[model samples]
Target: MMEAANCSLRVNRLLLDPKFESYKLSLDPLPCYGVELDTAVAEVKLRDDQYTLDHMRAYGMYNYLHCNPWSPDSVFYVDQLGRVMNINVTLDTALGKPIEVFRFPSDLSSCDRRLCSSIHFTSQDWVTLSDGTGTLYLIHILRNDQSAAGKWELKFNQELGDPFIVLHSVLYTRSEVQIIDALILSIEKDELDVEGSGFHVSLEWISITCSPNDDKYEILKRRNLHGKSVPHYAAIEPDGNSLTIISYKPFRFIADETNQPEEERMEEEEKKGKEVRELFKMTFALPEGAGRAVLSSGSVEVTLAKREVGNMWAEVIAGDTQGEFVADPAQSAAIAERLMHLTSEDLNPNPDCEKPPCNAQELEECDMSLEDSTTLCRFDGNTTKATHVVNLGGNQFLFSLEAAPELMPCFSLRHDVDALMWQPVSSQGDNLWDHAATFNALGYVQASKQDKKFFTCAPNFSYAALCECVRRIFIYRQPTPVSTVLYNRKEGRHVGQVAKQQVASLESSDPILGFQASNERLFVLTTKKLFVIRVNTAG
Candidate 1:
């Protein structure tokens, strides 16, 4: 167990864009799109054009798309303050007003104020607008008082994503202001710092550090620091990767007044008057493949105190390439088991059989052997075949044939069926088809336990279907309804489901049109003039 005490903490923050491109934010493209705070009523669609400026009373903001004569497809809009801006281009806006032609800033052009690739208000006070040009602005909108107006300043180089702001809180104090971001927020501080300056995987060499001045306690009222109720400060690492700041007021403490000299009793008593700093030592093994599992080659060890005693607040920074660590239990165990299975030069039948200390050379050699071994089947595009090496009928009749392409052609699978109903394979329609490329990219196939081949497709000449795997295939069907079955090879069962219809264009009833599907919910592509279904699946 490593004790964390008197340690200097180095902090790092990681912000990632989780790709929330799908949810069509019902942000109205009309001039009066915002909610009227006094009335709580939102304006829907108002005509946005040059003629709109004529009725200045009706024009609250310009949120409509403008088509330039030269660039017919380019969308332009004037903001609430009547500053012209481009659509789909992230720009710095003041309360939905373009910064370029802001009412207050007459000297700066829209392009001069620095443009953001994406801009959205996290809150009235906390705004996260990014330019993706390596610059991020965290504008703190102060109160609307005469002194506080136009007092916004950038937090400076905080490469934050739009969604991650939900984890952050801006702390204002008499002395200092700080922003703490956490996936888990602690109302009451209870965390213990792990030992050492840097994270370690082994407990044999451990370093622990603790501080008496707790962050939670420091933020508490000045009166709270005067009594026995003052919070005990501790920092603990929950694992190799998380740092938890903990605060607690202990119920009781063991006093060791037996051996202290009478001369130093007063000094010792004064020290005892202060809050006790709780600390602990932690030990855990780094599970194999932990680092590799998440596409990260770094790991960290965090030690957390028992939760019953204190409230814990934690801040977690993800691993980078510099400090790559692996700790996934399953992956780690599999790796160790593989190592143990390999032949070793210093093999011992006693305690060594259970766990062996392997050298770099031995580990490398073992990895090479495993890498050389091939899977049951490898798809080869050049030959347009799924090369199978499985000895199903033993060595006597080893099945080594590529699936005959004509034996089964995939048309369309049922939305709620177990197998893909196939048809003749041909590139005969306006639709795109590639037998060699399609089959080669197929992910996996299920083997048949029964006499029936684990594949089937719908009979449709209008659509083309090519089997990627024995169970999975590409069914190119147009016109509206479509259905397909995705078989799980390991379970030897087919998943029946309808493909979602893609909204290619918008209807005349629905004026708004755009494409959104990064988050995997609803994918919609639209045009103001027409509605087209790009992807449709009928069950």
Candidate 2:
């Protein structure tokens, strides 16, 4: 990791040492330097005499041991020049063979293409990748060597959002199965019949086809007892569909005698068996709907049992009509029926009332008044008038009303002015947006959570004292956590002014680039390089 001075980088690879930490070095005064650790597969950079450090532990950049070696693993193939290699890490790891079994160009047709720079070993099959961009790629690396080909190509498609697959560790099974633990997925070897039945679980999704009579694994099942007890099972199908169901325990149920009396244990075992076979049946349905429906790509419509769910039933429209219903325990069926009735009447109102004349006052004030606007309301009640005067926050104000008398009591700071500011849009026939070579401004912007407005701090001498302002953007590799101060020849120091602020924490030696204040968040080239300590407004 990076420190504040005397730039030094270190890497190491240690498997069984709990006290073992990654290489550490100082990065205080040096511009650039590299150091290697025997336990690590990479080197570190030093800046400003400081260096940042990260672990060589699992999930770190250098640790690529995910999935069985015989199984294809997509890794960030690294080249000599710190670029992402266009090659894929394969399942084939035969001695003396090319570690990269396949590449896009095969013959280096495009040597300019980047070499692997970073890798995230996700599961036996899937991995989420990035080339330092905000965009992440979720790819599945599988062994297609069913034909015993000498080598296989690592191929994948880009996944739009965040990572897809998540990992799972412990697994459950039915008592009937001889083995209590079935490690369905692993990153290591197959039939891992180790001393303990437990195996690391990494849940990943891949396209697979099942043979007609192939063995099928039972995941979730529940058993009903004579009175109240029931057993439930949660399973994942070969195709990735999840199933949860209740089933009755079989007669061969065995009770753990260690925890119960011998005579009672036999009786309890029989009771458990009977409980497994009762009333609860599996009612297959979607686990949950999109929590709240919205108009995204299409109108909000929920289809259940091959029928469309009417909007009125969900309070989307004012009136209700007869439509298919989806039973939900959260909402009342009676309320749903009532809403449907209301929707029909509201949308299909009676045709007799003079075709409802439009309100001239509303039409004149409406933003679309020039068009044929329709009347939305008709007031028939008699009107009353009143007046009130009050002083608020040392300011006296008077207001008149033609409504209820309680309007006076309702006058509180509910609509009080929270903030005030002024900016010159135009001054001296020059627009503030315009700037000359001699004018420079560096302003600090902060967000006010209470008011929800981004406030740009007023420019002080920091902007005024500069000789000339150049609208230029520069990218520098910052490998230090400590803040730096930009000095001027005349002014002693830009007190209270930060040239660069690490919202939360900063690392001294980790190579950081392309960081912008507007889009806050430090980007580390790789997890092996540096693990940034981020700034959180909440804390």
For candidate 1, the per-residue lDDT at 488 reads 57
Return the top candidate by lDDT: 1
Q: Write the per-residue lDDT of candidate 1 for residues 429-493, one digit (tens) a residue.
A: 31111222111111111221222111211222222222221222223332222265555576686
The TM-score measured for candidate 1 stands at 0.19
For candidate 2, write residues 361-441 as lDDT tens digits. 554221221112111111111110001111122111111110111111111010111111112112333221111111111
* Candidate 2 whole-model C-alpha lDDT, 0 to 1: 0.23
**In terms of TM-score, how similar is model 2 to the real structure?**
0.18
Q: Which stretches of candidate 1 lie over 4 Å from their true place?
A: 1-121, 130-136, 140-341, 344-500, 503-539
Supply candidate 2's per-residue lDDT for 401: 11
Ten contiguous residues minimizing lDDT sum, candidate 2: 406-415
Q: Specify the highest-TM-score model's number.
A: 1
Would you list the C-alpha lDDT of every candidate in the order shown? 0.24, 0.23
